[model samples]
Target: MQVQFGVLGPVVAWDGAGDAIALKGPRHRAVLARLIIARRRVVPVFRLVEDLWTDPPADAVGAVRTFVAALRRALEPERPPRAPARLLLTEGPGYALRAEPGAVDAWRFEQAVAATATLPPKEVFARLEEALGWWRGPAYAEFADQPWVRAERSRLAELRLHAVERQAEARLGLGLAAEAVPDLDAHVAEHPWREDAWRLLALALYRTGRQGDALAVLRRARTLLVEQLGVDPGPGLRGLEADILGHAAHLAPAPGPGGAAGRVWAQTAAAYDRTVPSGARVRLESTVGLLRNLAVTGGSGLQAARRHRVAAVAAAEELGDAELTARVIGVYDVPAIWTRVDDPEQAAQVVAAAERTLTALPPGGHEAARARLLATIALESRGPLPQARRAGRTPSARGPQAARQAEEIARRLDDAALLAFALNAVFMQTFHRAGLAPRRDEIGVELVALSARHGLATSEVLGHLIRLQARSALADFPGADHHATAADRLAERHELPLVGVFTQWYAALRTAATGPAAAAEAEAAYRNAAARLDGAGMPGLEHGLLPLALLCLRVQHAQPAQAEEHTDWGPYEPWARPLALLAQDRRSEAAAALRKVPDPPHDLLFEALWCLTAQAAIAVGDRQTMERAYIQLTPAAAELAGAGSGLLTLGPVSKHLSDLATALRRPR
Candidate 1:
């Protein structure tokens, strides 16, 4: 018979035979409760005695044994005839109760709460509803006065409140706001001091087109706060009031036939459209505000619209009006996306919206003046040719007439900081694309020249440029050492994460250039960077760059198993798997896998370099193929030749390339 015990609420013990198993007395109940909660585990006799009697007589152990015997008899009245004594077993200084997980109401409650985490609103609501339904009255009502029971009861009460909140939130999300209102209203009435409940009620009211009522709710909350605690409502509640007041005409709650939550959601969407871009500072402030607000509130309408609103507001602010603020805000958005939202599609959409807004802004008004804004937006967009063209456009220029616009902007922006920013953005976009290494190098030289002229030696812009140079070296480009050394110096001097990334890149390149032993120090540096920065919420730079460097080390070590464990199969999977396969001596399979990798145009140069190197290493006997591979890498090599102090791997990679050249020249 399946029996469930829920004395934690009302004493309810029912079996499949439809008979109530009498659970009587506080001590007897405590014995059963302790045994059930610690089911299949031993509760030492001394521990049980200690729990039952905070200050016990000398015969505490003997008294505990008597209670246990009494509990055994009560649990199995007809056991003497034939039933085994398997329900409770004696263990070393303890007792164990044999029962399934659902046998205890507390266990069931925990299970329900855990199950609701990944489920949709309807499902979560159902589970929580079932769990909450089991509560007939105050938990352990008979023993509420007891210390142990009081603590347990308080814990259950808190869990119940949490479940109720989750259930209300789910109902709101599922467009059942009206149905949730009554329960939520009762909850608010029960605990009038609970701000979250009040907030939920206001949200529901607003959604139902009860804008006046919603405002009234806030006013009531304000009054309640003053009356109860002698303080005004907090920022979140006040902000809701401000939103309603500021956009009253637009927020008139729809008359209810459907759910009020849905209406509220639609209203919020409309509000987002209206208030997002008042000005640069306002937009930035609003975007940052919304992101933070949603994190704390955890409701539907306003929170749901937060990402889109933030993106739109950011976009509107970047329209050549407030360049520095917009750029700073734009950079801040990258980390915010990952930390704030679980939905990748929604996060990506926010970024895309910001990029589109940035792109639509008028260009060439004062490239030098707007250099920071232009550079930040260009980098965020991740497309060099388009950004370069946009940078060139002026009110008077048309067609090829504005071809020199980028250079003009760079020249006019004589500020070293601004020019360096633009160049780094350009370099990032170029290097990210497959075949653009040569172009990246060419542009990089120009940036270096600009840096030299303007004395922009210590900044994030220089860090970015140096990191790119290190990447080129890893791809076996010439003169990578210069960039690597510069990046190292800058990183050491400034103590920045970007420098740490460059250091790893340099270490990896040095390893690849020299031998496995040369890479040990580099590997240690990469590990340190990964530990320090991977999840630390740093923005704009590649957080995964350290992981890539680690993978490079795995290739050097030929540890396929370790590589498989650490490497993620997303962006770097294509390169990672092939590298792993080559390491494992699966040459043909590695080459075949490399062929399937997407050939994004900009990524071609680095891709070709790595692919050719891997192919040559695997097909050591094939001189002709090695020669062909070497020829494909020449353009990238030449591009790296002029690279300066920023290149870290040039020395090691150059050596590897020389060895490959020597191998190719030998008789086949």
Candidate 2:
């Protein structure tokens, strides 16, 4: 007869047919519970004697043996007389209860919780929810008062708390931070000393945009720790507080539906695998090729997309089709950064791969594949053009040539997606030069129309985003806000969470531009946006962006600039350092530094730096540098500074041009 033990709630046993096994009395149940807690290990008769009674009775040993016999008969009613008991076996000193898998609820619950560790957030949450459901009340509930069960009960309770906290973490990972708040609130209330619980609750509140409430939760946690535990909160809580204060980007949920999209891709991949005919290499190659493009724009993690790229490239090469190989290679996995160069090594590899694939294909016939390769090459190689130009070197036209060719081919092919991609490449190449807002606005219009017509979610988001930047740079806040609203709505609807980061930062920049009164609020917004970026784990995206924003605000609003606040200015260091020095009243040093600062690189950052330089030169009475900055910034005078990224802005360029006109005695 099969038997299932239940110690998670009450110390009870049920037979194979779901009938209750009579446990006789409290002492009888205690003996069985003691054996179960020993985990199938032999418990000496003497130990059982001590466990059953605080003071051993004269026939305590005999009483234990009788109880064990009763348990064996009840647990295995079909056992023949004198037959060795299977469920309860007699050892040399005492006995052991043999429990099989799923026979013990407590053991099964523990196993389920352990299995959730490697799973992604959604699966982890699901598995943990199921595991936690196995707990009826508590471990060994009816045996709760027994001295032998005390330690085990406490351990099980702690495990339950851990499971609760992990589930909350999974919720946060799934972008359900608001949903995690109430449970975490109840959890921390129940377990006041659990710092992790308090931290999670605070984080949830922060994600929901309740900054004050989040900080209050942390404060309450600190008070509890100091009052109850007589110690400070641990490093995790402290670090989280600092991260929250700074608006660290890592705290934000992933920008897109990476987890959800991964799940969808997994299902689609399985379907393809199931339908593919066995030994059909060409079909397999075709399947891989189709999946490769999906993975690139699937909003999944980079590693997953890279895996698909590798597999697709390998399959394409195996088929020995040059056009197919080039197409596969052309669909790069890395997300493009428009504001600045981030990953040079990966970009270089992509350019080299595309070039080599293009060389392998017959030049004339593979127009679609060739266009894709050209666009990818342009995107990867466009970064250094501005720097080369700044060094008085005639910049290579290869990148621009590729972007033009890709766009031309895409237009002829009548493929909207292809044209959108090629236009994106053209945008990347042209964005390196300053004073191109009008041109960028034109591209934005076409991308929006094309992507909307094709129902391409990602490309449509990109379109609205580009329009937002161009509008902001043109000093059209209402137009910028319109596109920002559109982009944000699309982002949420399509699971592109990262779009909010840019929109939020622009909100801050707009706030700062409202004048000096809004500086503090704007600063907080920037820090929060930075935190979101950090949470997204894309470091280069936020690099120097914050400092530049702060500096722009300070200089524009005539606020006192603190040089020490910007310890790391990243790529803007050379251009921004002198301005910071000049702000500190170091005229000679500022002028010398200004002289060393070369003609500004023509990139997204160019107009902002030029305006900053003009401000610093005005302060130092350096007409030579002022005139230089004036000439460079003149064409962009009608534009807004640093608004090309749809992220940050430094007010209008005309404002800086006005300052230069008054200082250098130059007519504007």
Q: Model 2, 1-668: lDDT tens per residue? A: 57998887888999997778999988999988988889999999999998889989999999988998999889988889999888888888988888887888788878878888899888999899888887788888887777899999998898889999999999888877766888999999989999999999998887776767889999999999999889999999999899999999887776567645533443454456457766565564465545554443332343355455555566766677777678667655233435454555555555666766888898578888888888877776755544334445433467788999999999999988888888888877775556899998898899889989999777787788888888888888899899899988987887666677778877887777676788898888887777766645344566777777788778878765656843678777777888788667787988888788876665667788887777878877889988888778777878988777666667888888888888867676
| Each candidate: RMSD | 16.8, 23.1
Per-residue lDDT of 1-668 in model 1, one digit per residue for the tens?
Answer: 55567765655566655577775666767777766646468888877787788688899888777777776666666678545566777877789887678878777887798789999777888788778887778876666666655666787788888888888877776666556767988998887777877887887667655678778888888899899899878787887788777765533433444446566565665466456765535555555545543432222422444455456545555554554334434433211111112343443344344445445546756345344344434444432233334456421222112223333476675556555555555544444322344565566566666666666554433543444554453354345555656656754664434444434534444544455676677667656655644433333223344555555444444444233545453444664566666656777886776666543223222533354344435443545445554554454443332122221222333444565666766431
Model 2 global lDDT (CA atoms, 0 to 1): 0.77
User: What lDDT does each candidate get?
Assistant: 0.55, 0.77
TM-score of each: 0.45, 0.58
How accurate locally is residue 506 in candidate 2, as Cα lDDT from 0 to 100?
A: 74
| Model 2, C-alpha of 362: deviation from truth (Å) | 1.3
